[model samples]
Target: MKLSRFGGILSAFTATMALGLSGAGAATAATPQARATGYVALGDSYSAGVGAGSYDSASGSCKRSTKAYPALWAAANSVSSFTFSACSGARTGDVLSKQLGALNSSTGLVSITVGGNDAGFADTMKVCATDTESACLTRVAQARTYIQGTLPGKLDQVYNAISGKAAAARVVVLGYPHIYKLGGTCIGLSEKVRTAINAAADDINTVTAKRAADHGFAFGDVNTTFAGHELCSGSPWLHSITLPVDESYHPTAAGQSGGYLPVLRSAA
Candidate 1:
């Protein structure tokens, strides 16, 4: 299958990480006295650290950022071995086919953020960012439909696959942060459109959380972790609309460190 054009753009936006850390509390997990020996990261651009500056050249087209939440958490926790397989535009299918090869019995930890692409999240965002409110609303409506109708099954399939491959690994499924600030103004995006986008995010999280629980995987809620620092907030952790477009609506490095890292660590 040909990659979605928007997926390529998303990949480019996440190719680097600009470092800064502030706001949000540390995520609390039951830290074992013996740290995990092997960690594997799986998911989409959010997990790959798209808006964060600095890509790992070794990761090639996946554009995995060295400063992404998974890498940061692995380093901070001193996990002895780490494999960052999360890609820039991965859907549930991609995880099943491409990313899961990194997992095995010895894998002690796994973290992922998926299902958004399967619901066409980037396409919705593009419509909202560049088109009229009506068009954006239509796109969001489509996304919500997919989120409700198809996303749960897709998430279950991926989560079940992960469980099968890494039975002993503590799996944590991460959700997406709200792309816009609630009750706040952003350039080009009207209040209604922003609300629709955020609502779509919430819908995705709801299904993802439910599926994770069904499969006995931990669900990491970044919504609470990212509260007060959404795009256009006083200290926004997510990048607002930007010139290159790919840079728009992704987590800044600070978001990965402060917002995502803490929440994922607490869940892990």
Candidate 2:
């Protein structure tokens, strides 16, 4: 499939680390261990760390780097082996089948980052590039309606499949942070559109969180720790519109450290 024109530049720059701890407050301060006795990763570009910095040559997928949260979390906690099946542009159904299907009795820990592209956040930006906030908001509202109706059941099915595959594994469902702030800019769109996008992101997180709980999986809310730290806010976790290398609607390297890392750590 041809890369979307907006995301093409980011694809060109695709590329993408860790620590440990100990303490009296060991539960919090101590390094959280990977649930996987045998690790396996799943999901999309964010999980793959597409624009967060560097690519893994062996992975042969754009911008999939070692420093991405999954790899970093695994190394920090000392997971000796893992299989990462995360790919750019993956949807939940794709994850359930292609990524999760690769697992078996040996798999222990599983993590996933998904739902945004399925909600068409990226596609909305493409259509609203020359439109008004009202136009974009309309698009967002429509998208949300479609997503809320469709995604929950889809997420449930995926989670159930994972549970069946690795009953002992800790399934981590990583949620998205605010892609834009209350009011932000880029490519001529308005703050309202950004807010709409952020709100929609919240919706995906909410549904995913519920699904995780239902399936006995861990839910990681990256947005909570990143409160007020959206892409428009000077020290944004996501990339600025002008940064050609940063994926059009994704996080930057800083985002991986400031945003993604915390979410993974919280899971620990």
Candidate 3:
């Protein structure tokens, strides 16, 4: 009788301890990540979801796609407010003037994929696609030069602006993926061209990452997720000299859903 009572008490105590620990663990996990109530998507074509299709007519010339990573994240999280202000051909100045309007003290989250357009990504791809490897390398070299010299200051301005606008927001600066798979078959460009293109992407990402870190923002690099999925991998996530002219060399719908979405999710 006495022994039974003791065992019952012991079991009850153990169960209570377990529940207490479980509650603490839950709290620890939940408290670290601030709830993102309001989100603003900023930056250029990648952020606008240009090549992913499903364009929102309201976005007009911006070519904002409903399938972009920012949209996917907002839909998944069901944030209180989401502003998709990213445009197709935006540069640092564009973000400063047009996109910053969406940010405020109440903004809880921000995501951007800029610096690419500023680094002349579109023209670099155009050169790589239509010109010889020598020309491609030259264009890529110029882009890298811009990235090394001028991009840091531009990024600093934008990051500071974002921080100033959304004081408490958790900013996640997403990056672009390598366009081609080196050593793989290219319809027009060669392996050397692909390598140079990928190298330029690396340079931009490195610079962007440094700037993001300087501003205490998270840099969501999609390159790792995009590996084995670059164009000429037999399963490509990006477009190749695509139609509509604007879609060329951009991520396809699959790229947004599979590549970019996961990176932002993990960072955000």
Best by TM-score: 3
List the candidates ranked by TM-score, beginning with the highest.
3, 1, 2
Worst 10 residues of 3 by lDDT: 184-193
lDDT of 3 by residue, 1-268 (tens): 9999999999999999999989998889878855548999999999999999999999899999999988999999968899999999999999999889978866899999999889999898888778777888999999999999999999999999999989889999998899888884667777777788898899999999999998899999999899989988889999887689989889999999999999999998
Candidate 3: Cα lDDT at 201: 91
lDDT score at residue 154, model 1, on the 0-100 scale:
90
Estimate the Cα RMSD of every predicted model relative to the unseen true structure.
Answer: 21.3, 21.0, 8.1
TM-score of each: 0.84, 0.79, 0.86
Clashes of each: 8, 10, 0
Cα RMSD for candidate 1? 21.3
Model 2 quality (TM-score): 0.79
Off by over 4 Å in 2: 1-36, 183-187, 242-246
Worst 10 residues of 1 by lDDT: 18-27
Q: In terms of lDDT, which candidate is strongest?
A: 3
Model 2: per-residue Cα lDDT over 1-268, one tens digit each: 3568658756554521012223334657456544447778888889888777678887775457787887787777766577778888888788876887657666777888878778886777666665776777888897788678988888888788888888778788999888766643554557666767777888899888988898888999887767767766667777655454337667777677777878777775
Lowest lDDT sum, 10 consecutive residues, model 2, at 15-24
Residue-level lDDT of model 1, residues 1-268, one tens digit each, is 3579888877766653211111121212343345436899999999999889799888877888989999999888867689999998899999999999978777899999998889998788888777889999999999999999999999888888888988889999999988778675666678888899899999999999898998999999998878989876788898877754665788999999998998887888
Candidate 1 Cα misplacement greater than 4 A, ranges: 1-36
